[model samples]
Target: MLDIDEFTPGTGSYEWHLSGDRLLWSKGLLAVYGLTQAPDRGEGFFTSVHPEDRARIRQEMAEVCAKADRFEHRFRIVRPDGRLRFVLDRGVVVRDATGAAVKLSGVETDVTDVVDASTFPAGQGAAPAARGDGRMEEADVIDALFNDAPVGIGIWDRDLRFVKINPLLAEMNGLAPEVHIGKTPKELLPEVVDIDGVTSLLQEILNSGVAKRDVEISGCTPARPSERRFWKEHFFPIRSAGRVSGLAAIVEDVTEARKAQETIDALLHELNHRSKNLVSLILAISRQTARSRPDDFLPVFQSRLESMSAAQDLLVRRSWQDIELEALVRSQLPHFAELIGARIILRGAPDVVIPASAAQSLALAFHELTTNAVKYGALSNEAGKLTIAWQVSADGTGLQIVWRERGGPAVLPPSRKGFGSTLTGAMLQSTLSGEIEADYSSEGLTWSVKFPLNP
Candidate 1:
């Protein structure tokens, strides 16, 4: 066993022996002070300490010696090399037989690795944490969580001033985090009305002594060039000294979710309405098919009907939110591949995400295009190639997609519209609410669709 007076280095630790106004610092202490010598006054350990902390360290030393009482304090020391070092000073006070203060000893550990001084336990007389690391230590874990977290975080003070902000919340204001700190919601975040309103809500918590949790709030960020979307905000109160002090809010940018939900609800409503309306269309189609080919009850038509239902099933699976573009393309192209005796080449970014409603519409439109191509266009021949490529814009505003066909039958515009034409047109118009063009040339057919990105 080691004697209490004999300080041993464990992990990052140091021992300091205080006797009168002089200190005998261990090798570990010297290393932390960035000193060249152990217990050598000539090493200038005192000068290495940050000037502001020197007096407090001295005063605490005097009190420990005067009362012969155990004491602890934290202070910053400037390394002889000029780097600031944060250290915790803790030790016992020893006395003589007459009870006169003789020695004060303790250990100083460097805790600079941890981020966020507020998160660390600051002992009495512990120096206000060094200015270096702003984040609470263990930033890697936080970084991973920040990327995966569905909600946003914002740290604020009692005065409603922002202290720290997570990337998600920072992304909300279209501003970087550094620009937001020390700014009140109304001052820097005028774009965030919901956050500005949180000021009063936090005030209520402060005045009433009650913490607010999971309170639902909604508002829009400042208008961007395209569209303004809304978000649902959740405010959580941060407390200090057993009193409501500031706020730690988590914001969920639910604009897409809300829009998707609305689209689903609307689609469900339209599905019901169209289920009734389509009966007439189905009856007409059945009558027309029966009249045109009375003896031939073409069961192949049932397969087509099944295909439509399967498409609806896929849409329902995503709740009309979005679908995997590659999966959608691959799932719809196999039949056309066999018919045309060629392959549909899909070349683009892998796993590029798209909205649900857009997926449903794009899937249907592609299906119709492929069916028509197999029957009349490029896919009709084994020598043909159907290539599709997509790329997202730098601004993230929209995606650019190009579909080109080569070495196929000469293309010509349809003389009259058909089910495939009407279906493709309607689906693109509804889902993208943007742009579509099918250019027919002697070479082949080129189909393109531009879908709006924002909800």
Candidate 2:
């Protein structure tokens, strides 16, 4: 148990200034590499990087300092004593007003302890010969792997009784290590002892003395009895006098990995559905624009399509998750972003996230409102002001949005509906599933939109 905290990674900060053509390292960083600053060797600050990793780290750093890309790299380092260690660097590029990358800075962490030494071939990380006789040192290496390795390790006897189990495997089974010492899978978790259980696998390993690889199992553990977790396991026979004795099991928790693949599958399906729907929507908008304004179809259709694209871009960036309402509005009015809080005022809960479909429809509606404001409404004059506000209902299941314009020329309600007018009126109301009110008062045009917010 004391071994759990025996080894810990170290971390430090770094900064590279492009214009100054220099690098700065924190004392903690030098400590992480077990190096002392030579007072006059700033140019050679990064010279300690292993030769094999130098070129790659330099290239990645160049990308961060030139293209302003995020940096996340793992590389090996050599200490003055010739000992090798692994480190991970995470950084971000800083840009100026002209979008020029000016600085690259972030933290670096030592991860030597986490890199399994046993995986390296002999003469590399593996012990030369343990105690000169190699017994004690070999045992220590195996002990380190058993206790400090990220995976779970367990030993089972021929009768499939738990002989020894590490803390990680104990936690996975939701049982203490001692409790599992004499218990079989059926005795501990009979429900999970079905066909996929390890009972037969261990028996086979004991019978044939050949290891069985890549066996997966799923079960509920006391740690989280309600959630069925999964593990990818392997069994290797422990030999005695060239014959099979007990079996050693290496278990890897792959619940999150499986769930991630499942999520990617669902997202792909949704993207497919969304793509087809968007294409159909674009086709409908094109026909409507061409029919309503034959001479001005191109510009009108393009403008509306851009608004839809803006919404889709937001949705795609967030993996089709709910979008920030303010972000959705600002995206549609990108040309007026600088004037957001002044000429174009926004008022609402900043954290209001809206669904993708609602985001798209609302994007179009806001675009139509903005176009009208620019051409014939408040935004057409110097004294005009546009105020947009939204609120969640008392029940928290609905939303109310109001787009009000002030100080514009006298307005009259349109006698015939144009493409923007029809969409914002009947079409938006249908998708929003609530009332849509447009007040074309002599002062200005105010559009009030209400909708149910689906979680």
Candidate 3:
């Protein structure tokens, strides 16, 4: 029987035989120890094992050999150069004719590689064993979930090293995946290192072991200039054995939605400011117009101003965005109707809707026309009738309005142009971008205008 304990540079070997109840190491084992002769007869080669590993190695070897178990063990030895090297031995215990253990034989391989953990190839060091068949399959499922999620997902260790990061997570942070893998946020992005708020939030997530969702985080990416990105961040504890492991994060980008919300807020602020200013202007105009007019004309001026106010009301309802011509006409025509009784007929394309700018201009023009009819056109005579008709041209390029009167005593042109007439003509030409014509016929008067409907 032979027991080899350590590895030396030179190799030696010899056969050993047992005589009388005494067992001795072979000449090869003696030569391996750099001795020309065998050791003291009773001393075992286990003495050659380094002092730290001798007892445990001997105990483990005896247990395995006695139980007829597989021989597997590791120990260290001090070489001739005074360097310690680790060795692993594996072999079976040989049995005698009576099936009783008599000798042990094995092969020893240098395992210094395993003892120096860093020297092991990446991912080849000691890891948890698959105690159950389903463990690895479950791990595979977890890996798949991390890889396939549409939203960004990542796992960080307690030390802030990225244990796992999906491709989507890397893209969301505007970094290539390899750059983030196995790196800490402080290592990859130094700007975030001293950010106390960020550090606190991360620590809170790690310590609390509770999930937090939609917590907004800023300054994730500083390189992009187009706009700052907004993120709805979710943090949760990665638990193992009912203890908090680290943190897992899921991020959702919401930059566009945030911008839209900001724009809406700004518009509301502007609209409120504009509306207050407009009301102030209207009040001032109303007070001044009444104070400057005679009592008899005050009612007429107030009525006209009211019509103007109605048009502005419509515009304000639309957030000053737009207005419909038909809406403006419908809202104000009842007041004009009360003045003329059955003497006037109104007709036009009631379906036409115009912009807010044009609606205000056209509403003022209508007020002028009604005022003129009440004063001199046809409403001045009890027996007279006025007919107002309008239509759009074939190409929808323009609108033409005709105001005709009949049963008046005589038709004549006024020597001086009236304010109402002047207002209607100027507004039709300037505001609506069209022409006005007043035709004095033998039976009555006819007032007509053609305006472009470009709006």
Candidate 4:
């Protein structure tokens, strides 16, 4: 036999002898079951079970005795005073030398405070299946839904004390159900009650008997004292005998939901801003193209628009976060793919992400450079070559990009500024807050630009 004194103080222990239907209960067991005195060993034990659960307990006990196997059961026991308490009974059958069952010994725990409706037997606290009436008892249905609800639910008396709280509400407050009984919101959530005005709101609901819906509360709770959480709470006045008695509250955690909404709002704002900038840029490009190349205005305008569109496509793909420098270069230079490895060379600080605002201007500058090279510079002949290289500054404050062309024809400085020159020089400087320098040397056309990486 297990030593009753060795078990935890509040838990109950028991032993049952199958031969004579004898039973023994420890002192703790008597206290847990609210028994004033020990009953005749086996006579009164089954009588203490709730009437509805008695038959099932008897059948399960008989099966355990006959099979000589382990048994585990949970049921409600009616205390001497008529209160119903949930308990768990677990034991292993003891066998004799002949392998016949001799006794069963195990422990019992009063789980009334912790048990929820989901653990109740079918048709008791659980939802009823289709049957003769096809309707469940009102009290049972209320009990099932209240305890099994996903959101926090609680009832507070007119005095603002907790009259009843479901497990979900208790857990949200970082307390057990029993601890919440008779406690006010001020006592349970002192840290946040005032900041969120929870107690005042509940009081108002009680006084006015009016319902408050979707009241947002945000603050720290004992459950996570250091972390802030948000809840959307609905408060309704509870009425008894046609008079305001208390208040009932349903609370849903909306912390993540609110965060998601903020993210979407930010993205939408960004989209609107970028769309306006794109329109402004397209207008400027059309005006400049028309002024510079009037006879061929449409082709020039279309080419510039296509280059800007490619850059916008890249930004959209990245959620307008940042555009990779290598990706931008590759996208703007697709026309040179055939000569990329042999005659055209690209080298730069790898994996650099350019800011969105600077990406479009830089893409246009690259288009102008490539167009000039194909028309008059190095790329016009098979023997010509082009080299593009870039690097971040040693202090990491800025980036420098160099474009050099060679072997096509002797280079000469433009006698007058054209659209291509203006874009690569003045336009880039104004848009990117950068500096550009061009050298028309006998060897090649060399151009260099320095700009802040972040700006």
- Runs in model 3 deviating more than 4 A are 1-297, 316-324, 336-343, 408-419, 440-445
Model 2 CA deviation exceeding 4 Å by range? 1-150, 191-197, 204-210, 236-246, 316-319, 337-343, 347-351
Q: Indicate the TM-score of model 2.
A: 0.62
The total number of steric clashes, by the backbone 3 Å criterion, in model 3 comes to 1
| TM-score against truth, every candidate | 0.37, 0.62, 0.44, 0.70
Local accuracy of candidate 2 as per-residue lDDT tens digits, 151-175: 9998766666665577798888887
Question: Per TM-score, what order, best first?
Answer: 4, 2, 3, 1
Instruction: Report the lDDT tens digits of candidate 1 across residue range 1-455.
Output: 11232232311233333343455555555566666665444235557666766676677666777774656555666675777656655556677798877655455555343223443333322434334756644434555676467677876666666655676787877766545544567766454446656678877765775656656554444435345566666666665656565667777777788889998899889788757744654564456446544565475245335445555566677665566677677667655545432366788887777875465456656766776777787678778888878887888888867778888888888887655565567546665776778788889988777776775
Off by over 4 Å in 4: 1-140, 191-196
Instruction: Check candidate 3 and list the clashing pairs.
Output: 325-354
Best by the lDDT measure? 4
lDDT of each: 0.62, 0.77, 0.61, 0.79
Candidate 2: count the clashes.
Answer: 2
Residue 20, model 1, lDDT: 34
Q: Could you tell me the TM-score of candidate 3?
A: 0.44
Give per-residue CA lDDT, model 3, range 1-455, as digits (tens): 44442233222222212222233544434444434554443234555666766666667756865677345455565555566555545456666777666665444434442233232223222222244656464444655787798788977766555655677877776676544533566656554324567667878888888788888865546445344577788988776556676788897777788989999999899778867865764565456445544564667667767777888888878877656555665566665555433666667766765655576657766776666666766667778787777787899887787878888757677676545555567645776677888888868878787877664
Instruction: Supply the global lDDT for candidate 1.
Output: 0.62
